[model samples]
Target: MKFCYKNGILDWRIVVLVFLLYLLHALTVKILVVASIIAICESGILLFLALKRRLDLYLYTLVIILATTFEFPMFVDESLKFVPSIIMLPLISGYFFLLLSLWPLPKMLGNGSIWKTISKKFPFLFSFVSITLVLGIVMGVLSLFTDSTSKTFHFSFFVKDLMILGVFNVYALYFMYSSLIYPQFKQKLELIIFSVLVAMILAALFVSLVGAKGFYGTNEIMLMPLSFFFSTTIVFFLFYKKYSNNHFVLLIFLSCITFFMQFAYSNALGGKSWLVFFLILMTCLIFWYKRAKLKLILGSIVVFLLFPFLLNIVEKKTDGDSLSSSKLVQALSLVSVVDVDWYTNLPLSPKIRIEELLNTNLEFVKHPSFALFGKGFGGGHQDYRYAYGGYNPAAFSLEEYNNEYFIRMHESVNTIFLKFGLLGLVLSGTLLFRHCLVCNKSPWLVLGCLWFVFFWGYSSSLMSIGLSSLFIGIEDVRDK
Candidate 1:
């Protein structure tokens, strides 16, 4: 059967007929019910394709498996939101596939040719400063013309969009410059060292003199530098040559250690669990690191041992009570669903949640008519809230859902799905899959792709202003 398909001896009509039968049933049945049948079929197809040397089809099959895994868990309980997982898994998978399809096979995958092509057309340094200055001026003028509180001009929204666009452009330019102009290992090394030093100094200053009041109370300008620094460091270390290997490993390790120490001290002194999450992620990455053998094993072991302790520390720090201890006991007691009425009573984080709702609602409203074709270039509303939070004003409310796990909730996932629909989902998924495919052959590109994938979920609209800047920056770097 596989041989017949590979050789084109089997009639294509037969395959189409089979697919139609399955798809018809899929649409008619409950999604989970249909998905189970499709999953089995897809698995068989994947196995067949793998044996037949149909690499592309095999990969697509792998994507289907991954997508299904992510989606299926959500369907087990309607109350347990699964839409986000379903939407994201396929979207990312399709993206990776699309990216792979665009590139020349295997060897040329991460050669930086794509970046070079764009950079050759536009000079990096001139483009960077010029774009930044223009955006900054436009934003400044717009800010002056409209009242921040006024609904008419929506100055806050416009300014936010401009800022997002500016940041995206800046990131793109930086990556381009780094890849193309910073040719030597020494240049990359120097840049990383400088960035880390600057970030450390700023962090120390913020921690010591500025204090929490100053840190959170300000207009977030100080925070911007730190965020930029950390994000850049993440990008740089992921792609940089000298520090890309064992040095990067050491840096991550030390960083995790530092975070753990901070968590410990915070528990003793009263701090936050947000930092603990960051630390856990860092620790997890150490094990996920592809190169170092011993570090991965050791890191895994350490994480396992420290897991309970870390939970206790986090719980204590977060609620300022024995809540963590009780939760631990409940978890150990195999209490599957622990009811907490306090959740329903608690108010939502208005600032963040409201913005998120607005962005999602906007996308949902715009989606029906504009389903096939996306809002063409700068056609999207330039609301600051949407730019930052991916919220749609049309769909959600300021009223808190009270679920701390809203990140994985259906509401959150459905927002993007509503924006893009099936077509958008496929396109986005293809792009991500393609990225993975290309990067698989090119280690450097793999690192870059990983960085992008990791953050894609945390932000709104993967293909918007941010990606534009990122792609352009990467292109610039590759060309020089």
Candidate 2:
């Protein structure tokens, strides 16, 4: 815990350790099953530590990070083109260990004295968890009457979806309860954040040098953490004056590191990331030079015109084709409704995803009762319609397409609605909102909550146990 130097960057020893850990991740991740097995072993160790009352946040977080970095493949058959990756074991098992270390939920639910203690000690968390139990019941009831087709309904999907839906609550519960047991909670929380930052940055570094499977084995994995780095850096810079250890030099280094991430990732994405990242940088500028409103307006104008040009270029390193040339205009039009859904530019995926969301929403409006309770776990919706833009529709059957889309649950918020319904959405959002409000003084958590809202529109990692501790560690800090 002791750093030789005083600046905000993690100490040299910690950085070295992170790099060493990243190396372990690199070696184990290629087979993916290797990483998965190691993760399972680590989980056993974690459970033992927890039972022995020896586990701490840092150790738990480190193991969880390693386990989560890669997808575990149980079957890889190229001849049949069958490769199935195991998701829930890595995602759910760590949490059982996590929650056990924090508090025993089974006992707490029935214990009158325990409930009284929790209620008096942390009223908001107490209320949040109590409501969460009701939500859990609704989740269970809706799951029982699941509308999932046989093609998509599996026990893993059922459990995985449940976790994704409740990801926020799980972490919030950990954050609130973990506070009672852990001392110097704020410093420990900072370490957890730094731990994630270092882990991902080192992962990105490993990918660049060694040409390995991207962090945790996914090629595009670095993107989120990189985006996160810039985001948290923005918040950190906003409060650069608050923490005695925070340094401007460290801020510059972080900005540059995030820029590298953007550059590295741009080659892989279609276009939306550029727009989002552009906004992130603009926000960074506004905060960086807080007093320059006139300059900010002018800078915005410049970025608005030129940023797309830059994006178009990045989309294609050298493109003279007319359709490719109009990408600038496409980027602009996409931005107009970009906030509607994260689906943008890509022809079939975006169009179908948006259409599916609208269709699912209409289904809810059409059936009030369905909206009240939801389709439950392992739920799937009617494809409603499809628009295969560039690809030949004749090549793929409608049933295949429907099945493919149904299982994805990519439009994350709608996935919540489909499985859990409007009631679930309200309960889930309220739990998150209350937890995010843990410390109004922290703009970081407020902005983070907003980011997740945007994220829910696109991806399905909503329930995955990622960075919940970081949020808890900071947001749960009482105002001094």
Candidate 3:
């Protein structure tokens, strides 16, 4: 993969430069507009060169960089106004990337004949991209008729899921082409990964000291520094697990403990005790599988049983609620397929969090049309603030409500229902279960890394996008 810079100037430097400008945007408040201007200009030039060469990779990178950097942090006013145009660029770019990357496959698999595709060796990759893209487009068009506070948000997220799908395909295609065809491209991945890790550490530190008071605030900052270390640990565990690497194991242990301590004691995201437990259990399971020792299994079971006790101690010291009193069980209880009317008239409990899910789902299936098409992206939650008491747009703000209720639909499965109705639910649900149901090396590793991502999606939309990309990149190959 020796990049011919003399003939066609696309290389690692372009990727690094764009990411640096994005970091600058995230760090300095005043540099947002200026950084975007420079990055977008560079992207335009790259896109022009890519078109001349007919290389879709450059266009793919262009769209992802745009989408990744333009994190619409806040909404301006009654209307999103200029915000919609800015955000839409990424979605539109992402759609083109999808088409460029995987087109005729959709045409062949358009009918109910997708089972043939799912039966392949690498079914996870093919099934996820095909199903999500087809269903997402159908639901996006259908959702346009539904009322929403902002059309920009509605349109952008309508196709937002495609961005992740596109990323997966583009990345896989890049690695395949580089490995089999060019071979030199493999070296470039290491450079990109190393640069990203270094930049994330520096940016995380800078943001903690100076940028905490902004929109992301203190709680996010507490977890910021762990990104680089955690990412590096996962990379090494996946790639270098065959060799003797006690240091990697130590790093993983420290990362888990540090992540738990920071989030637990800081009174940040404390209500998500279920998620914390699930993560701890998954981590233990991964390490235990890697070692396959009886002591590890017994020790994991002990810790699993005592997790609530540990949470109790942590909560008492921090003046937070105990995990035993959490609504996790109640939320899980609503997973059955009951009548809509039954869920609607159910009495509210200590919190209306689960009730909100029931009511929204009822609203979704109340009518045949609504049940078929759904209210679109950014729809289904206009009056959610009333049910949850009040909405707090800021993280860790004084306004005391489950801020997650603002975007999350209690369950990602149900969220799919609210977005694209029964059809969408079936498609996404199939992708979720069938892809990773078999516990192979690649699939298992992806599950370990992203179990919490999918689980948390049931409670919030946090990892629904960013971390989901990791699942697609994992392979059974050791070198990857």
Candidate 4:
């Protein structure tokens, strides 16, 4: 199913791809159905590719999983709307279909190899899991001490909640372990990486331009989708460092254009968006240098060219031209601070984050026991967020959810801290550390970890980071 190859240039296929995309736009009758159709059909294609033992299936699956994470057509604004959002419990996104598609995946794709890879290190992983198991039980008991803000509670369904903790809450272990076990396939995975990047960008652009309006129903286009896709796009751009200067330049150029287009859609994107782009830029400069200076310059050129277009679109789409000042949008965003000392006229959302994070950290100091094992899984910080809340557009936290004690943390680091404390932190930190350490060695693993930073607080992050430590003692096996 891969349209791009490792060797020769890809001009003709790109042209054909553009033509096909144009045709898709011409034929699109409904926008919401577009996501649904893409979800189902893409899975079918993946299933077919997996059964056929196609080499690029994993990367393509990775792209789709990411795509649906932020804006699957089925999205509805509600608390726990997506459900466990891990493997179960509540939220089901691209993972559900991806799990189904990959079950029949060929062993040549390393389906059986994972166990083989883990067999030698089973004892090590078992120890970690055993420790976590004890911790989990302790935490489960602790969960009993706290309340769920329910009226008449029934079964804790301890088993179910534990499963939720594993499958849904911290899902990243799925990829972290898999990639740790078998980081690379014996295929042109490198080219497939580029293909996946190109495909996702094109898809995102189409969605951004065409929107979620069709004869069937309409969905508002949002900034988060672009934020997720494009930030990863920049990471992928950095991943292209091994390739030619020409390729690197092209990726950054496209990434910049993607960012401008995203801004054109909505200028109200919060400060985190700015921080994310900064991280992307800084990551490139510190980790993958030399060409980064050039690429950033090129990106600025693209941004400059598209500046007027962005403003015009924003003026047309939004109610007033009086949004955030151009200078503010151009400069760094005033990110939320956890410190109570930090004070200024800011939005309620960041204030909520500051309150929640500050209070969550305080919980450990306030309750000496919590720092050891954490509030346990499913535990969270409660706040009267609504009392301070106002109309913060597109703020997920501001929504009337779960008695103001948002179960999910704004970031994975914080989430793990609230739930598992030092033990959980060590477990998660090890994974994050591994991926960050292997950022240069294992592009795939690094890719997963990087996104978890941007997409903290989902069970999906669990896929990338979990209790598994089977391969930690192996000493970064990919490069060596």
Candidate 5:
């Protein structure tokens, strides 16, 4: 296919079309579903084009979008609650598209120093998927031998978890293979990155102006893309160098946009504003690390101290008191550990989450098998409130409940332990270490990765598809 562009830049026309479709989804239900269908079709067509043209980055882009954004509601209740927005279609389609992308992997793997490095590191990469598959099989067999309806036996959970893991593994392989297959791949990769970032920023602003309506939930339409804008801007500024030029000017403008959006979101966060607050602070830390100015660090400390006051003002102005005046204070306070089971439906506080981590640690240490194999995939968490005969009317909605309902953990390492056991943790840690080691050549990328690691200790943002891509994309490009 022949393409035309002004000054050799990618055509912005496609971006405009996607943005219009995004707007139409918010305006009406029928249009929203239709637009989703069209978007999926576009991905399928793009996957084919990518395969034929050997453009693996485009293929990776489509897979990332499917995993991250394309959530089709298989079932939702009458009150618009209980949206089981499983990506079944994306899973099925992404599988085929991934297979197509991998058609040339064998040949690529047979050549190149990059390929050799990947081949040597392949076991660590494969270990995660292998452990997951083994756990699934063990759980399935246990379910068969024992009662299938046992609380620990979740067939749907096993299948869904495996499917997601499979897709992730496919993308990892493609990342490695494509880095070798394509020359000057970073330039091509960044073009797609900037294009996606610009489109998301424009669409987010449009949605915010239109009272935040979207085919997706209002909160999601506003939050997801804007969060990406906030995050990708940090990654870009940290890595890219063009001092006192248009690039730096543009960065300042975009930073202001993201700040206001996050500021507005600080109100009524169900006591979860600290996570967002920390991530933004980390972004600034990235900037300071890039230049290493003590003055900047001291200024950031003052701002951190004053941020609670700012949040309090925003909450007062919005007339929302869901978050306490002492929210930041409460976040820092520690409490004694409780003796609750790992799967209880306890009311969440910073204390409770910490206590649960303690409980998980105690249990895992007591029973070495639990530390080694875990309770098996999906056995780590349960609908504890329902299991304990408590109910909340808003349980079905995403934002209305506590963190435990969402299967969120205060620490990714703990979550990994419960889900994949010690072996998986070791493997994933090694892989991240490998990525970070390669990033010595790109100190800014190392800073970004470090920021993510810090965020993971407080929240599971690192597990999100967008952040995962950022974490992977930053280091995937070796120094040329």
Candidate 6:
């Protein structure tokens, strides 16, 4: 197959045709017409790319398969209503596109010394396995006692989810280890970027379909992992690539756009704490500007900080307080409150919250009698009632707060700790710390990775599929 980009091979005419076809399909209400057009477009792209021997095309196909596989199971259960497969389908597609762009690979130059050093440290793999085994034993024991049908198990769902989560935890560890030791930055970045774009497109489509529901309600949370991947990739790109003044300006503009988009979505859909998200981004920008004094960074920060305040003032003057209670404004207010609360109650020491969170997870710890090595996959209770009292704890509940702290406490912090315990937490933390260390050697990369890590902590579990791709991508960039 020809790998060359021949002249006229990708003409503007073909592009326009594809766009028109897509536009028409989107405008039409006929279900069959839309489906047929989508299938044709997707298939045509695949066929064209394949005929041209563009293996890069496989990235999209892989996303479709992976996203469908991951989400299809949810639809199978008749009891589970409100499945948003439409949103997931496009998200998966966008993720694949992003992955294609950010995969990393080490420079194939004089790097024998680095390879030798990696070879010497190879024994860490065994150490990681041993640690995982110990944690597995602990989890097995906890599962037995907590999951004994006779016992009044409040968190039995933890045990069931643990088995699935445990496997992924191990996979995540191995991925990190491979990333660190092998250091295939180029390949990983490409994969990560590809996955992120696919995820983003899907997320946008999903949110649109769900009439702009909150993050969790529209299953927008799934996109967080993908967002981490792309944001980090962009940061890495800016750090490594030689940039002109124009490029730097563009970067600032893009960041501003992203900040506003997230804010708008948070307001329109009651999913995330918009204020917290904005504050985090603002804080990062402020620190970046203060430390570097780069005009682009400084300008972006100033604009972002002042934009909301100015908007608020204008709204109050024009619309009055009652009329100014727009969804976006309300979301922004919520975010502000949550961010203030988090910092105000910040833990005094390192690992303090994680440690405390682990203790709560001890309720799920079982005895060795249940299984010394560990309960095999899917060994815990399958009942949703056992998990969160028949309530989707991750979902918004009027009974509790909708801030990041509560979300962390319920969805990510407690979930991982309960299932994988200390080992998982340590390994996950180590992987992130390593990524930070690698990227930190360069300021631009460091800033990018930091942005991703912050969002990852706030929105999703470290072991999640999207987060995994993110780490892999960052690791890839570092290798390069």
Error of 2 at 286 (Å): 3.7
* Model 5 Cα lDDT, one tens digit per residue, 1-480: 232342332336545644664454333322345544655565567656655766564654453343224232311112332211123233353345435545655765466666457665455554554465566457534533432243333454444444454344545566555555665454444444444444555665666776743222212324232124233343345344431233455556655665555444322221343454465576567678788977888888887676556644654564524233334333423111232532232234454455445655664665565577655544444333232123333222232133332233445565556655777577668857766666534433443354344333221112233333433445444343
Ranking by TM-score: 2, 5, 4, 3, 6, 1
The lowest-lDDT stretch of 10 consecutive residues in candidate 5 is 74-83
lDDT of 4 by residue, 135-185 (tens): 656775676566454421212333433544444322222333344434352
Of candidates 6 and 5, the better by TM-score? 5
lDDT of 5: 0.45
TM-score between candidate 3 and the true structure: 0.58
Question: How many angstroms is residue 141 displaced in model 2 relative to the true structure, after the best TM-score fit?
Answer: 3.8
Q: Residues 1-480, candidate 3: write the lDDT tens digits.
A: 233231121244544554564455454322445544544555466556555653334533443343324333331121222222122333354444344444323433354433453335345544444454455556556655555335555555444544543344344333333233333433433333333433443443444455442222222222231122223233333333331243355435444554544343322232343444455566567777788876888878886666545644544564423332232332222332253654553324323555455656656654457676555444454333356544444321121233232334544555556655676666555655654453344422443245333332321112222233333234333344
Model 6 lDDT tens row, 274-294: 343544566557667767858
What TM-score, computed on C-alpha atoms, does each candidate reach? Answer: 0.38, 0.71, 0.58, 0.61, 0.66, 0.49
In model 1, where is the ten-residue run with the lowest total lDDT? Answer: 217-226
User: How displaced is residue 417 in candidate 5, in Å?
Assistant: 1.4
Per-residue lDDT of candidate 1, residues 192-309 (tens digit): 2233323333333333333321112111112111112122233333344544453566456545543443322222111112323433456446546755666676767786566556
Steric collisions counted per model? 41, 3, 2, 25, 0, 41
Root mean square deviation (Cα) for candidate 5 = 7.0
lDDT of each: 0.35, 0.47, 0.41, 0.45, 0.45, 0.38
lDDT of 6 at 27: 34
Every candidate's CA RMSD: 23.3, 6.2, 8.8, 8.1, 7.0, 10.6
Q: Which candidate is the best by lDDT?
A: 2
Instruction: List candidate 4 stretches off by more than 4 Å.
Output: 1-4, 7-138, 145-148, 151-165, 168-193, 211-228, 235-241, 245-249, 267-270, 281-342, 365-367, 384-404, 433-446, 459-477
Q: 1-480, model 2: which lDDT tens digit per residue?
A: 454443443455555665565566556544446665765665566566656554355444443343234332211111221111122244455345335434445544465665565566656545644554455446545644554445334444555545544544554454555555566554555544454454555555555556543222122233222233323243344354543246555555665665665555422222344445555666656664676677777777787767546655645753423332233334454554434543545444345656767767766675566767565554555545544333333222354354543433545566656766776577557646665665345544543454454444221222222334334424445443
Query: Which predicted model would earn the best TM-score?
Result: 2
- The full ranking of all candidates by lDDT, starting with the best, is 2, 5, 4, 3, 6, 1
Model 3: C-alpha RMSD to truth? 8.8
